[model samples]
Target: MISWLMLAQAAALGIAGLVVAIAGLARRPFGDLALFAAIGAFATLVVQIVASIIAPIAGAGPTGDLLEYWTYLLSAILIPPAAVLWALVDKKGQWSTLIVGVGILACAVMVYRMHQIWFVQIA
Candidate 1:
């Protein structure tokens, strides 16, 4: 995994998470802005997934347990959409929005963990 790309992905998700969180705090419903932010975060993870596959082929593979790295990556990829879907389904006003915000934040943390598994931990 590339250091710059990992950092970029984490930062993007962090920003998205923050945006949604602020919206939720303001008592806003799960609206376009929150949806867009979540989708943007999801898109970043999708890019990371592509990078994960191509980076290894380009000889920039993880230094740690490949399985662990992939597990984190795959799980991180699922979070945003699931949160969005849940938010849409629950429809409990700001709480649902807040849940999405929290879920996105969790994804950001997972991305950081993935970076650690790829670059910090040793096999």
Candidate 2:
């Protein structure tokens, strides 16, 4: 994974997490802003997926276990949409929104871990 791309993904997810967290705390339903934020973060993961494929071909491959890195990347990609779907289905108000926020934050952390697996850990 590219360093800048990883950082960007983390930042985007972090921002989305913060947004939903604030809305959830304020007792707001899952609104357009939160939805858009989640979508935006998901878009970043899509970009990361493409980058992961291209970066390896360009000789910037992971120094660690490629399988581990890809697994993390793929799993991280699934989180946002799942959270959004949960929020939509639950309709339990703030808790549902908070769930989405927490999910996005978790994704950010996973992205950081992916960075470690790709660039820091070396077997």
Model 1: per-residue lDDT, tens digit, 1-36? 688888777887888898888788888888888788
**Segments in model 1 whose C-alpha atoms lie over 4 Å from true places:** none
TM-score of each: 0.93, 0.93
lDDT (C-alpha, whole model) for all candidates: 0.85, 0.85
Candidate 2 weakest lDDT stretch, 10 residues: 90-99
Q: Tell me how far the alpha carbon of residue 78 in candidate 2 is from the true structure, in angstroms, after superposition.
A: 0.8
| Candidate 2 lDDT over residue span 1-123, tens digit each | 679889878887888898888788888887786678778878888988999999889998888899998898899889989989998998766588887888889889999888888898888
Model 2 clash pairs? none
Residue pairs with backbone overlap in model 1: none
